[model samples]
Target: MFYYYEKDQKILASERNDLPYAQGKPIPGAPIYYLVEGDPVLGRGSFKVNHPGQLKAPHGLEVLDASRLPEFPLDATLSAALEAGQLTAVNTGQVGWESVLSAAPSAGKKRLNILAIGDVGSTLLTGLKLLGGGVLSSIGICDVSDQVTARWEFEMGQINLPWDYNAFPDVEVVPVEKLFDCDVFVFVASRGIPPVGSKVKDVRMAQFETNAAIVKQYAKMARAANFQGLWCAVSDPVDPLAKTAYLESNKDENGNWDGRGLRPEQVQGFGLGVMNARAAYYAKRDEKLSSFLTEGRSFGPHGTGLWIANSIDCYDEEISRELTQKTVTANLWMRELGFKPYVAPALSSGALSILLTLRGEWHCGSVFLDGVFMGVKNRYTPAGVETELLPRIPDQLFGHIQEAAEELKRVL
Candidate 1:
């Protein structure tokens, strides 16, 4: 059963007769519902309960059940059809993977493949190696760096220096050839980053132009190779690069474009992790301002004049002004602290984001917005990436976001 939701009423059912349920009458919500005709055990219907609780008249679409429901597992019909996997409880002590999904991804271990293991790439490798989740059998790391590759292959296999590697023992470096043919293709390579000098301006966005070109190159390679797996982009300027990869993959040889081969939905970017970090920094100053960590928002590029809006409920003109200043200047503070801010970005932007994404959790990052690449903090669910919509922001903050979009468009 599938139905369309209206703020005031259940407007109608899907015109597609192939769907399983019933139509909804007028209701005071924007939810659509789905009810499987005869599935009585779990209940005949499900409300589209997504993103905590905002649905007044929750619509039950079959897809919403993929991760949220216990009976539904990662069966092809659910995982692919509904775009779901069981969601892991962040509280592992209270609940484990067993409770999260209808079925776990399988205790049967399989090798994970990574492509372009640069700074972000290597950090991600470290996290995954430490995790050594049974979902991963082994890691196939690739990079242009023989030394870096060799070092990772040597380091990841050992049980010393940082964390217990034996617990998460499956990690290794591999050539690019082997890298492409794995279950997942983690694209952490970038055309440029970690600028050699301090004089580089807007360094994060500068990587955009270069990485976009690089992404276009790889899109063709993946398409030709018939790659059919998760393609995660971790390099800076992630959202646009993901868009470019999809765009390039779908372009015909003659340059005509269509949404085929690699669909736009196939890609995801990791830049939002940095924004989340900025928000966290602001959150710690005081209890009243803590929701900046608790409820703050950072949903755009990692460059100058970025968007950082404190929560409306907690919004104080002075506090927000200060928090915004601090969030924007955090990177510069790192350089002032006399070290490149690589590890945190790597951990915040790459490893942790990917882990959260794979676990089907909410995250701050870019997702396709308004029919193109737009950054909105979102969560990964069985159905696909869903961007979170914030309440109406203060007028000044809204102006900044609008300006940020315009700035991004001019470059793209």
Candidate 2:
């Protein structure tokens, strides 16, 4: 059902289902369930719960109307709460409850399959298995090293994470042959860290040349296996790796141009989220740059090509430069503190992007751009990926983004 807030006998825009969000699992024509805050009676109106596993909407929801409704996306906080079992159905202002099915652990639900388990991969395994609660059913962890595989199995058996165990009950360390059969495939393995003294500040770009070659092998492997799931590049130089997977999958039968690989939409890059976070860190303490919390944007590759615009809406050249510098050096902060900064990158970049992808909301990831891989904020759906294009952007920020593209072109 459509809800309209009537304040002083007039409509004030509040929340609507037309905007993209996880509508929960349900049937169409389901009754409307409302969630109202302190003041009741503001939400008044009705509409049919549109489709199975869909959000309730006002009757006769039109395309234009859906588009016109405010486009605020349900971000990571909401998703995390919902995943950890912190939230459930709430009452509408009309003093009633919305009917919702328990998306609890049930039969026949396919879970995400992770293909590698190394430093980033092993940490990711621990986080997803422990923190995901009931949202993920089973995790299929694979690694080339027998030692790593054995280690994960031993940990999952006894090590308890903060969340209640026995909730979902299916975290498995499986063989690589079993990895391709799941709903989501994450690639974190690589052969390109330039043995010590690499001195590569731009770690992502430095690994691109080698990671590109490494990813192609898996792309072919994935295609041969006929896997139909979200393929993510969690390795460094994410944008290029994402493209490599897509391109390598499409070789023709005659050793010519054929498009049989994974769809361009199925692959994604997940490195930009950390860049956004670093910019926010610097913006909060600097009074002159405090406005960035409300108006900053980080764009382009997750590497040296990144554009950290100080004020996305206001566009201050000086502050933008400072913000960019902070983002580039954010990693060094952890290095100086005597610990590897892997935790935040694992959480903010990998797990967060995966959560957003499952929920079908916008996030920073690699997508197909002009016949190649380009980093952009977008949403992943069952059909494919759709890049979110904001109405307006600072020209100077875009110029830097273009330069990044040019630099990427030279190497890629």
Candidate 3:
């Protein structure tokens, strides 16, 4: 392994000869990161690259494993960094990776902008306006319909607490051209949602084609505007739409990827939080599934492709499968009662998770993995996006996750 230091950051790479901007010396006690080439098709599965025991890497990328270091030892500081998620694997294959190595000053009290004030968007906007005072300086709302944006702006303005005018983030209607002006741009514009009583079993997937098209249009707009904020996908079929935003924004006029638009780490799908919440809801009601509340984790997409683990350590496949079924169909249970399940999703996935992201806290969201946006527990860091790596994931549980990724790959 080759150790290099760029400013205060320390990087270890497999290839020593043609390094990006790395030097030979390493800084003591600084955060350690392993640099590896990312292969979209072959790197579909997650691996344990920074865990305690043995380091693993995605297929064709194991040459950069930490275990291959000649004399490097997992000392106390390095172990602590691993547990704290400070140790990351930088994808040198990604565009704009050099920018990630540079120190980024915190943009305290950011401005947030929301597109479309429909059911999901409006509810999410309300949650953010009420709870985002510490993280957000202001909230901008934009929609194709003037009446809709005007109504939400007026309604959100009336939600201030008595004698506490500055307690919440103020909301205002923004023109379409200025939608990406803020530090965070949330894409909540969706179309072709099946009605409450529609016969469609997979509502999220049903809206994908239409929603993908809508997402592409705004994605290009974000490209043209050179949007530098986090792009949150809250529309139905969030995972694919998030990928669509990243892929579309990077295209040239002839639809060739130019790698000049939003980076993969910048686009995140905010649809998994509600799935995790719903799993917990079911787990709370069933004593047999009670372990999920603390030890469980949700993986994959928000809809048909999602999987839930009852416990990471003592994973009960039967109980976990049952819980997964309940969580996956929770939205359908609401539809059966003649209602669209938008409120919980908007708040749990869209608002709460996005707030956690802005605060740089651990949150459940779909991040780019392999060639698809796979939902997982991830957080933003000064270095970049860091995903949680468990000590061990049961083979059965991991298989379900792989299947979920394949399903998403087929859809996109």
Candidate 4:
């Protein structure tokens, strides 16, 4: 079954078996859904582009929940169709499907480059140097300060033992011009991070106006170099910064928008993983909420408007809200103790989550959805950007996701 919204707020549903192949072409401006059995894939569909000269038609674009919808089996037919580009999943309000699932690069050593070696970046460097041995070929360190990059090269070089030290990848200082010449480019550059003892409740947003400017320069750099790799945004206010990188890279010097540079799927925010880990930290303290240890999922942005589900199977709104508040404010606790929080985020969100991405494991991060970068459980697979499709998402939880997306759109 397929369903779509009309101008009159009416839902038009059709079963795949009933529709003829002639009508298989999607309706322009309308979102199309395919029911696996009777369940819908939440916030996912196929959107058709309207004709250039066509009349202003009804826009059938809205995020829909699939919690009540039945489970859709990932059968061979669907996989083959996806692989052949015959079927694609679209986010709400997306005009057309652009990312095509293709055979991904075989698992092997990847060259990772990092920009900046500040508190967060240095800690991230340590984690990657120690933890990314299995998959990383080398760690390229780049910073505006040559001293910073050289220092890390010297410090990281001393960590390995004299005997059997070939297990770890080499860490080298990379020139700014060569930053993008790697499999993954992690952006950790920022300006105006709030100092300790500041009364600001939202430190992440405070860095946004400045960090956005910093990231834009590199976005254009990536364009000029025609770079093709993962553009990881590890700066604060991660989701919006990721979008800024995407939007700026595709724009010419005159500011004309061009569909070149980084693709939407290539830029992802690495902030959600820490939020998920934070929720789990709290969930462990309370035995009653231990379900989050296994079944809980985190969604939305890195800072404000983060949403945490206690457990999809046995959801409790009250418990979920508490978890979210804790997860969102976990950083404040460190600040309250007269210290800045960087270790956990660098390790959990930066090093660990990125490793999971390379391994094609399920990890929480922000991926481009529709027109905004929204945080969700997504993985990089040969099949393309794969988001978690649950059997049922609680209504209250889905509403939170919708609201978080709206908040993210507002940030742009």
Candidate 5:
């Protein structure tokens, strides 16, 4: 292995010859980052380096093969550093990597802006106002209808403790032009949701085409404003919409490709959290499925392509298949009762997961993986976005995840 240093940051690389930059000797006991080339179109992006049972180069980003790396005598210091979240793979190929290396860690409360005051948006706003005091300085609301935004502002303003007027983050109605002027921009504006009694089985997917067009407009606006905050996709069909925002923002006025917009790591889809929560809800009721509560995971899109693992260690194909079906159809259960299932999703996926993200904690969100936004357990760090690398994933479960990715690719 070889090492390099730039501006006091240490980097480890597999090769020393023909490196684009200068090389340096390894520094003992200091935080280190692995230098790797990443393909923006087909790579895992940047993430915290971990030791899994198997490693494969993300398609098109191969440098030194994973099999050639040393297996025995694992560096204790590197392992410890990884445990402390200090070791990350720096994707030098990404557009804005240099700034990431030089940028300071993000601290202090963040300002959040929400677009749309619809059912999901309003419910999510309520949850954030009640619980985001420590992480959010304020919340900005915007919508097409002035009356809607005004109603939410008044409703949110009344939800405060009598003794502590300033205990919660204040909610203010913001103009459409200033929506991007915050640390986080959430896109909850959606259209074409099937009514409760409608025959649409997959409601999320039904809204994709209309919602995709809506998000693209705001995405270009963000590009024009040079938005530099986290972009959260909270509307229906969250995964593909997140990718749409990232892709649409990177195009020129004539629709030519450019790399000056939001980076892949900057946009995340918040649809998996509620799916994960639903799996747990079912696991608590059945003894045969109880293992999911502690050892399972949710993967893929929020709708038809979603999958739930019954247990990572003791994976049961039959039980997992049953559980997956239940979780995927949980929203339909509410629709049968003459109601749209927006409350749990708003709280679980939109508000709680976003707060966890701002706090730099592990959360369920769809991140860029091999040219698509696939749901996974991920968290943000000073270096960049870091995804969980399990010791091993069951073959069947892994297959389901890959299938989910392929489905999303087909849709988008």
Candidate 6:
């Protein structure tokens, strides 16, 4: 039995005729629940339990013998479903089940696949190769150029000497046909990136059209293969490109929505992590806004619409606007220095955030919200994609997030 809140009243999964529950009237303080029977007695979904003291399973959903159940393992795929409002979680009063679900043990070592190996992709590969040992069993790389794949394979192979063979996950060239045979498929391939000397004010958005077209192809491939892994968008204008992947995947060849492929939540944009990191960078530099290091938060898209709050507890519109501008324009500073801004994005947004996600740690990234892919602080758990919910969100900051969501909707 599982518990969920309906119309401010607790309801049990067995009580509802709805097998797959809809997002109903939320209970004042209960996590939505999903109950499935399998070898792994896990509840993989998402919910925000703000009032833990008030948390309780609805009547008739109590598991009197939860000790017989298996461990609740974290499943990222189900977490994606939860984020899309496609899933929920079990009750807090369900005996050993509550502790098992809360622990959210690792699913297992994941197999990762990456497409492309350009400036950003190569840098991202380097970081993942060196840092993904704990969570990744191995990495599969694919590129248009055989030499590019071969070079990286050989280079990455040397990272761990024979004596320290276990230091890093093994890297290999994966044929394009086998790209989706992994737990995570990162789309780093892009076209029409502005040249270093080019004077494009918004570098990320400038490549939107070209990258969208490129992402559509992979999206179709994922659909055709019935991919079960994560679809990660790491290109410029990341949020829009991720939506393209989701929309294109679910459409038929005639461009009709058949709902036969990737779900919106399964595809995520990895750009906002860098934006948040940039905000922290600027916050640390300015002593006046040092509170940001502890209480500040980043939200919305990765480009011009990005939002940065100085402190959610003590919101200052003036300070937030200043930080937002700095975070969004941080990439331009690299261009002014005659460099393309790939290092920070590849490391902070691409590698570090992905690692944090595999470890189920709090990180900033874009996830599907409402009808659009929006960035927010979220973490993966057995219960699903849990977005950070605050007691009181500032009106000014919320306005920015809403505006950014509107701007993103305009793109697709």
What TM-score, over all chains together, does every model reach? 0.70, 0.69, 0.89, 0.80, 0.90, 0.79
lDDT, model 5, position 369: 78
Residues 1-412 of candidate 6: C-alpha lDDT, one tens digit per residue: 2334342233323233554544454333344444432211112112432222112321111111122123343344333443444345443222233332333334789999999999999999999999999999999999999999999999998898578888799999999999999889999998888988887888888999988889989999999998867788899889999888877887889998766667554678899888888988988899877778999988888897888889987999999889889888888888889898999999999999999988889888887664567888887765566666566676677777778878987876
lDDT of each: 0.56, 0.60, 0.79, 0.74, 0.80, 0.73
Q: Which candidate has the top score in TM-score?
A: 5
lDDT, candidate 4, 33-146, per-residue tens: 322121121123222112211001111112223333334444443334433433334332322222222223546799999999999999999999889998899999998899
Write candidate 3's Cα lDDT for 251-362 as tens digits: 8889987777887777899999999999999888999999999899999999987989999889999999999999999999999999999999999999999999999899
lDDT winner between 2 and 4, please give it: 4
Clashes counted in candidate 2 amount to 8
Best model per lDDT: 5
- Which lDDT tens digits does candidate 1 get at residues 1-412? 2333222232323324553324335333322222222211111112122333212112222122233323422222222222232211111111111122232232355556777766667777887776647456678877777887788888776744456444574667776656667656777777656554477656677788777777777788787776655677777666667667766876667776643445444466776687668667657756756867656777565555566667755556676667667776777778777766667777777777766766657776655433334455667554234555444456566566666656666656
Q: Judging by lDDT, tell me the better candidate of 3 and 5.
A: 5
Q: Model 2 misses residue 30 by how many Å?
A: 18
Error of 3 at 301 (Å): 0.6
Give the better candidate number (3 or 6) by TM-score: 3
Model 2 Cα lDDT, one tens digit per residue, 313-397 = 6889888888888887777666667565667667667877777767668787766543445666666432234444444565666
Error of 5 at 359 (Å): 1.4
TM-score of 5: 0.90
Q: List clashing residue pairs in candidate 6.
A: 32-89, 33-89, 45-383, 45-384, 46-383, 46-384
